[model samples]
Structures are given as structure tokens and as C-alpha cells.
Target: MKRRHFLISGAAGAALSMARPSWAMAGAPAYLTAASKEGNSTWLVGLTEQGDVVFELPIPSRGHAAAAHPFRAEAVAFARRPGRFAVVLDCATGKEIARLDSPEGRHFYGHGAFTADGKLLLTTENAYDVPDGRLGIWDAEDGYNRIGELPSGGIGPHEMIRLADGSFAVANGGMQTHPDYDRAVLNIPSMKPNLTYLDAQGLIVDQVEPPADMRLNSIRHIAADDTGRVVIALQWQGNPLTAVPLMASHRRGEALAFFDHPETVRLKQYAGSIAISSDGAEIAVTGPKGGHVLFFDGATGAPINGRALPEASGVAQFGDRFAITLAGGLLEGGASGGKMLDVAGGYSWDNHLVSIRRV
Candidate 1:
């Protein structure tokens, strides 16, 4: 298979044999995201692959990340960090089916994933007092109850994904915070961010840390393609004026490779979200702080294009184009440039948008 490479537009020419995405094979794509308002009210919205809003369910409070079930129309909307609850909604009916509470002395980390079989929901959490990162396991079929927890391998673990081989790739952000300081980072000078691989049984099998110079570049969000190759987005805790690699790549056992940008000074020090192109050959990293969705070649990790999007952060792929959620609506961007989809509604989209997919 001949793979076409573009810096920001990766999935342009890669064939199915090359991308090998099971969800793409199944057809009819959809996505889920948590949107909110200033009044503290929130919602979990679902959208068709064409960027049309399909369903919306009111949530109890603010939300950050969400996980959609692979085989069913169900989603778990997690409250932003320091929050203690997650609501499981039946997307087919827009009804709240269950509410997951953080165990005492712990708080939800606002991101989670379901196993390949959809039996357990794994959430990142910060253990109270002790202040270490933990993955809370919820039995999806058993009323979404807290069953147990596993070590996150680092502090302040943020986003995680289930890989094709059934192992989990977790981005342990490593910046400890307590509700005490209103989410103020406490370990910027010594934060040890790492990409950790956890097996089905929740055991850490491998780990890769960032280079010494970029230690403050926190690995915050992550996405994996068909081959289990992961691209990580980071939030820099160092001086904002110093241009640094806000993205990197890692395989299970290899050293994490930080990417260099041609316009380092122009790259936002913070990446709110990241998405790998269907062919796994391109990457889109959104920087709402800088108001642009920067695209890169997945293979070479070089800058290809940077499209200006006001408050552009949320991003996901439907088929050929990337769907980004901003206050204006869902914007579709590709080789031809960016345009808004005709999706309508009162959605105040958040920092991240997720494509519904198979693990």
C-alpha cells in the first residue's frame, strides 16, 4: 500500500488496507462531546459523521472528557477535574442510566475508556491526601459502580486510550494538583510526565518518559491509530515564550520522540486536543490558546499547515475531513481548507471532541 503523506492532512490517500480501522470498516460514524455554559449546566451531545447534531442530553454539571461505548449508543460524561461524579447516558434514548461517584478521598480526572469488550470503564483520578494518580475501574454492566483502582504509573494522569491489541496507552501528565489551590499545578519544576502502557489486567508493562530538557512539557492528551502507534499532546509548564515541542510520539517500548516545528515560536505552548488521521499518517493538534489547529505529517512529525480557527480546540475525524467543534459550530477542514458544517444547536463545545470508535 502506498501511503500519501501531508503534514496536517494525514489520512488523505491512505487506503483501508493501510489504515485498517475497524470503525471505518463498519461505516456510519458518530461522535460524542461534553459541552457547557457559564451557568454551570452541561450537556453530552452526539453528532452524525456529517457534522450534524443528532442527540443532546442534559448533564448535572460541567464536563470535560467523555467515552462512547463501541457496540452500543451509550456514553459516560465525566465531570471536569476535582469533580467526583460521572454520568452514564443511553445515547439511544437521551436518558441518564447511571451515575458513577468517585470513591472517598479521590476525584475524577475527567477522562476514561472502556475495554474492548465494554465490560469495565476505566477513569483517571487523583487520590486525595496521598495525591497520586489512579485509574478507577467501573463495571459498566453492573450499574457503573466503582469496583477497584490501579496505579496510573505517574501523577496527574489525564487522557488514556485502549489500543488495538487490548493494552491501554495512558498519558500521565505528572503535574500534581489539589482542589486546595483550585487546580493549581504543584510540581511544574519536577514533574515527570510519561507515556505508560497498561495490560488488560491493569498492570504497567512499559513506560516512556520525555527528554530531560522538555520535562515541563506535560503529556496531557493522547490518541492511537490502527497500529497502536500513539501521538501525544502536551501542555507546557515552562516559560510560555520559549518555543517547545507540544507534541510527541511513542511506541510501547521506544523512547518518546518529541517533534520539532519549523515555526517553533508560532506553535502554541499548549495543545488542548489531538487526533490522528484515519490512515495514521497525519496529525491535527489544536491550540485554543493560540486559536489554530496545526496539522503535521504523522510519519515525519513536521509542520504542514496551520489553519486559523477562533477558539479552535475540539477535533475528530469522520472520513476524509477533520471535524472541529468551536462556538460557531462544527467546522470541517481538509486539503481544500476549512468550512463550517450546517450543524445547528445551542452547543458551547469544549476543548476536546471524540470520534466514536472500536478499541
Candidate 2:
């Protein structure tokens, strides 16, 4: 299949460009990113297949996660800190239409999604010292008015996703912290790591717990394909210094080990992000510790190939290509500590979105 390429231009001029090589599959995608001048802000850049930044939208907060409205051209972005509200932006015009406080609290470590009809927004709240996790609902019509709240099921509800059955699947990383950002204390001794499936009204419909041996692993980020299968990314709670392999899959009530590649498995510390292709044929997981993107067959859970990327902390699928945000270099007091350090070699910023297409 011949790949189509598009050029994306920024308000200034050519920001970036993407080229879809012909060797790529028929449905494969090419991606481009628009980065922000301030690393702490949610800068939205629309791109063409040729990797050009044609339009840019500057969001008010450091957006940790985003979900495109199911049917609308707009998208919802969740801020990390300082700015605690989940704001909805007009993807086309780059305007803020609605902003509302997240029921999950002032510090949401990147978790928010939109309902199937685009009528509601769901997210997990993480306020330090606050043991209770909040599941917040916002009415999309009234500028994201808070309608209700529910238990996030566990402490530190970091990520939440919707299932095919119209239920909510959440990764409640069982850890406790103070909302002031003064301290982050982990509760490893009594850690209960599990996947909770909730009904539309936030009722627990099904629960799948990790194996007894890896109970200390905290399930963090989750991604679902068209078939309703889920792939969860885990962050270590028992020991941040320990390298543990805890990547796996779950469907209905069954759980299975997916990526056991020695090189990939050894990256227990780098399980920061996971994304599945729209058609359910490909899955990509990023490991900042390993500085690589691992690709696997979505059905078999077997490693296909991997690509080297910068310290990628977030991953997303734009059309057919994969988009990754590099934050490793953004850490304070690192070798690349200077403000506006060159990232991913050519891409520079505290936060940058890079799209990968097969050559």
C-alpha cells in the first residue's frame, strides 16, 4: 500500500513535518507534534501526515492525559498540578470552552476520559494526604459542571479507562500521599493491586487481581483496543529502586502474561505508558529507564520489534501512528538540566510530543 504524507505548518511557518514511507502497511499512520514554549503547559498542535504543525492551542495547565470527544472534533485535557481542573478545548479553534474542578482533587497524576456519547467526562483524583480516591463526573453541556462523585475504589487512582460494555476500568495505584506535594509515602505492606470494572454509575461489576506473587506492583496506566481487551502498565510501589517485570493483559475475568521478552521484561522500572492501535493489531509500551518503545502483536502479546526514543513518559495513538512525550530530560538537576534543553537530540523542550511511523 502506498502511504500518504502531509505537511503541517505552524502560525510562524513550518513547525514540523511527517512522511509516511511506502513500505509501511496500508493503514499505518505518520504523526507530528506541536510543543509548548513553557514545558508546564498543555500545548496542543495539530499536524499533517508530513509532520507539520499547522495549528496550535495553548492549554492552561500541564496536561498529563487527554481524550478526544467520541463524536465531536474537540478534546478534554487533564492538568497535573497548580491547575487542578479538567478543561475542555476546542481542537479546531484552540479555545477553552469549559473548565471544571476534578472530583479526584488538586493533584491528578494523569487520568481522565470522555463517555461514549461525549456527554460526560470521567477522571480519577489524587490529592495528597487524602486517602479517599474520587471518581468525578462532569456534564459536558454546562462547561463541564460537576454532576456527581464516587469512590475511585482504592487509593491513588492514577488512571481510568472505559470498557466496551460501557463500564469503567480503573488502575488504582494503591499508595497514599499528602496533597501539598511535601511528601509521597507508599503503602506497600498492605498493597492490594487489582483491576476494577465499574458500571456506568460507578458500581463495581468485575474485579481482576494481579497474581499473588506480584501483588506489590501498582497498576497505573491502561489502554483498550476495539475487542475490549486491556493492557495495563504498572509502576512499582514496594521498591522504586527494584527492577520488577509486571506487564500483563486482562479480558473478561481472565488475565495473561503478555510481554516476557528478556530485554523488555528487564525494564520493570520503565513501565510508564502503554497504547494500542486503533484496529487492535499493534501495541506499544514505553520504558523511560530503557529509553525504547516496545512494539508487540496485540492479539498474541508477542514482541514484534522495538524503536529507540527519548525518555518517553507518555504514549498515544494518533490515527495510525504512535505519539510519545519525552519527560526524562525534564527532570530537575539532570545532565540536561538547563532550561529549554535539546530533547530527543533534535526535538527540544521540557515536554515534547513525537510521532513514530514505520520506515
- For each predicted model, how many residue pairs clash, with residues at least 3 apart or on different chains? 5, 17
TM-score per candidate, chains pooled = 0.88, 0.74
The candidate maximizing lDDT is 1
Give the TM-score (vs. native) of candidate 1. Answer: 0.88
lDDT digits (tens) for residues 1-359 of candidate 1:
11111111112222422332344454443777888756657888777767766677787777888887765566788888888889887665557888888988889888998876666788999985797999887766556766677889999989988898777888999899988777899888789988899876677889888889888989999988888889988898988878788878887667888886664445478888888877656688888787777788877888787777777768887565588877667787753476787667756777888776533
For candidate 2, the per-residue lDDT at 279 reads: 64
Candidate 2 lDDT over residue span 1-359, tens digit each:
11000001101111110121121322222322334453444465544343444455565645556655554545566665334766565554456667666443445555666665556777677655466676666655445666665667777787788777666788877766665643355566777767777775567678777777677777878877767788977766666665566467888767746465445654556476788766677777777676666677777988776665666555566555455655423221111121222233233222223232321
TM-score top scorer:
1
Instruction: Give candidate 2 regions above 4 Å deviation.
Output: 1-42, 59-61, 81-83, 103-106, 127-130, 240-243, 256-258, 265-268, 318-359
Compared with the true structure, model 2 gives a TM-score of 0.74
Model 1 scores a C-alpha lDDT of 0.77
